[model samples]
Target: MAGFVNVRRDVDDKFYRYRMPILLTKIEGKGNGIKTVVPNMADVARALSRPPTYPTKFFGSELGAQTSVDEKNDRYIVNGAHDATRLRELLDAFIDKFVLCGSCKNPETDLILTKNEMIVRDCKACGERTNVDMRHRLSTYIIKNPPPKKGKKSKGGHAEAPSPPNKINGENGDPDGEENGAGSDDELTRRIKAEAAELNADTALAKEDWSADTSPEAVERRARALQSGIASLAVSNNGGDDDSDEDADSPYSQLGRWLQENPGSSAIDVFKKVQELGIEKKHKAVQVLAQGVFTEDVVAEIPKYVAIFAKMVTSEKHQKALLGGIERLAGLDYPDLVPSIPKILMQFYQADVLEEEVVKTWGTHVSKKYVDKETSKRVRKASEPFLKVTEHFRCTGNRAN
Candidate 1:
């Protein structure tokens, strides 16, 4: 009859032991699923047709043992003390089929029984050491088991995998639903090209046949189409109205002609046209016309015009035109320019103006805005400590005194 032992190593490097007998019996419907089961000494000895032995040894030694047999279950329990080498060999054999590191999945490892009451194993791959625990070993064994075979496809053919849960909006719909915000760059480009094609067809039809001096209905239809073309171009360029030098006969020229003819048109109409023109073209036109013709009447009607221009400066597309406009006004000392200065300075202070070129340009205009002596002095003082630190470290030798 085979025997089993339960052994524990104590802090004093001594082994405490208990013993039992191994039993074998056919468990109906539990063939391959049989797991190692521990039984008490009395039951184990009874199963083994042997008398129970509590705190008994195979021979006479400090090593301890206990034995039991269970006739009813046909099982036995054997426990005993073991030396480090013997315990290691038993543990290695018991855990041989499942000793992989859970985290790193390293199979090759050295078993280390420590004096500090830890059975540690070091993984060769990831250099991670883990304690040998029964729970961990059992879990690793279950994880290593192969998955069950999948069933065959149905007669209707293989069903599609269910769509993953939608993170945004959480609507239970097809993943290929309507796209939000700006569509993909390729899709946008395709749409723009298609729209441009339609616009070109309409423009060609108008030029070859219908004249603006013809019927009022025809003229109105043409104007509407032209307006749409301009709007489409403006949105495509992100409100940039500047035309490149390469395109000699640009859309802006057509829009500009329409604007000049319809001088009494609404601000919204003008704004739409302005949005259509390339950004540089819009700025150039606005700068020239605003100063010359924006007159007292126009300024009163659109008090927000200067404010809009100041806001436009924040945009990358219009930054150069905006900075140039500011510099020109600062040099000419334009009367209406003072009110826009505070808004510009606040923006400049907030923006990432770190580069030397940007700083130099900003420094020239910044001093002009700081007119209040006390406020200017306080601002300088606040920055002095940081300046001093930089100077001390020789990062920038010049510091505000």
Candidate 2:
């Protein structure tokens, strides 16, 4: 019989798709020297998309015992008499903290160490990059032994696949099992020359784009070549995925385009158009609507959009989604929008859209979806006013208990 279960599902879930092998622990030794051996740690770690040594080290750190992972024998051992039940409980904590994404609770995430040495999780499913909690001892270990760097993907979809090596049997034989090798030799030489010519042409074009001659004629030629290359590369990168832009066909993109096209459109008119066009998700619409509606006087207009925000954050799920979008929309793009975000958030508080729990969740991490690192930092800095409101509620014992 199979002996595995989904890490975060009910123990009785019969058809849960996400499964990891059961923690098979064998307690060995007696009296003063006791240890638990996890014989299938490598398999478990493979399923969890983590290095086996991480969990091994985590167990030692948590249990206040020594642990070792013997790669040669595929053995993971922790000193002490631990049971499957305790280890399973520990696994839940690990999954919650390190495995699942904070936004979507999906396990499809990669642990990234940024240039600032901050540990973060990049959720592949939702495109949310969240900073990891750094208070735990395991966090220290993770920082020291960070995951390997992932290759950069082309904007199309995934990283470029390497060109396959050409197969040649110059010394031994021909693929057709020919009795004579004379004809095959001539064919191979012709093929090599054609391939070399193609490579030379590509090199010449790339070199032309990089030419830095300062003469007037040469400068014009260089500019034309550079422009052509950039245009081609941009088209290649954007061909596969629907990268966001002002011209995209998505409802959010249409809203942004319409806003830029019709700056004088009334709020009622904008809302009507949004309804007629049909927004797929209100959370995403928040970002588009913010970008389209607000200008230098965003603070004065916060009340105008209060009804929209109220509808967006009506439930806990909506609150998380809307906050994620807000982290991007109110991010750092609008210097005008930045100064007013704190007051906008306070309105959320007064409207009960941003409850105390939601506010606490927003402060948990820096989001990197709609904004860059520095921009996100600025947005969070501008949000200090909302923090005071939440703190006031917390200090006065008005937290949602």
Candidate 3:
């Protein structure tokens, strides 16, 4: 464990085969120009079978800072000065979410974007296909920039591991020694070189020298932190259900009755009634209007109400509530159309009922705030395909310009 650590630091097995280099970070520049650079990001990314940009971008997203990727130079930077320990903790968070298999907790997973646009982690170790939580901001990044499809095949027909020509340390994969001052033979530089060399080495010794920490309390602490992070995604509620009670006096009921009374009412008429009822500012009004205004053909009917939705969705909270409305519309009211969520979302986006950032945020994680846990999950899972394709188009469009 001199230059490497167990992939699953919680598993205290002395013989754990999966290992990766210790994360090394260097703080560069001063004041407003300060940044944290990971010189050995390529080596660590290789060990995880992911693009170096992923963890770099994840760090930026979590820190609310900008990130820069220098694949050609083997340098990844996150703007603003940060401590190495903080970055290491964030790296652990990344590994738990993206790298380790959800079933086996091993770093032997392949990210596959499905036809429906959902990202699945296909674990080679456990034979399990687990869906990645798309609610994370990093999911958009992964969708935009997928990992290289497959490794190159060697002469023997086996796919050789990727060997990037440039390493932070000048020896093994390093092309130029001057970048990051990696050419100097200082103790830290030598250690980084050794770790980089170990990444490319396929010898049996490298596989055997892995260690883990088995302390139950330590493992529990890490698990609690991760759980807390996931729990934070959900908004606070008084434990009331999303749907309001139906009564003759209820504003939602009044609106529903008005909709039923005026079958041919236009979006403007609906807006007038919504304002008259004093429920236009309520988030749940979006849900009520979605159910009341649309029929069995919700997808076809969505275009008719885009103007109303635009007027109603005046804030981020309203946008989220609109998504919640769709969850209930498709998930509870018309379960049959749950499969058509991507189409539904596309229509919403095209109609300006939803913004790209809001949809991306909603798609990343499933929350009980919108509906019942199972129903919300079903809705978000169905929407993944659309989210993926949307991100892909945005990325390609940027490059085309």
Candidate achieving the largest lDDT: 3
Ranking by lDDT: 3, 2, 1
Cα lDDT tens digits, model 2, 232-290, are 21111122224444346756666666665555455456666666666522444554565
| Native-to-model Cα distance after best TM-score fit, residue 98 in candidate 3, in Å | 0.4
Candidate lDDT values, in order: 0.32, 0.56, 0.63
Q: What TM-scores do the predictions have?
A: 0.21, 0.37, 0.41
Model 3 lDDT per residue over 63-174, tens place: 7565787666787998777788888898999999998888878789888765444568889988998878665657645543444456684322223443222212212222
Across 1-401, the per-residue lDDT of candidate 1 in tens digits comes to 55454322111332423332332222122322222223343444332222222111111111112223443553433333223344234433333323445456444544433323234556666888886552222221111111111244322122223222211101122221122111122322332233234435455433553212435664454345333322322112334444532242564445435543463344344544554553322444443223221221232223223323322222232343333333333233233444444333333322211112332344334342312344323332333333333223222212111
Clashes, model 3: 7
Candidate closest to the true structure, highest TM-score: 3
Q: lDDT value for candidate 2?
A: 0.56
For candidate 2, list the clashing residue pairs, or say none: none
* Predictions: Cα RMSD each: 31.6, 24.5, 23.6
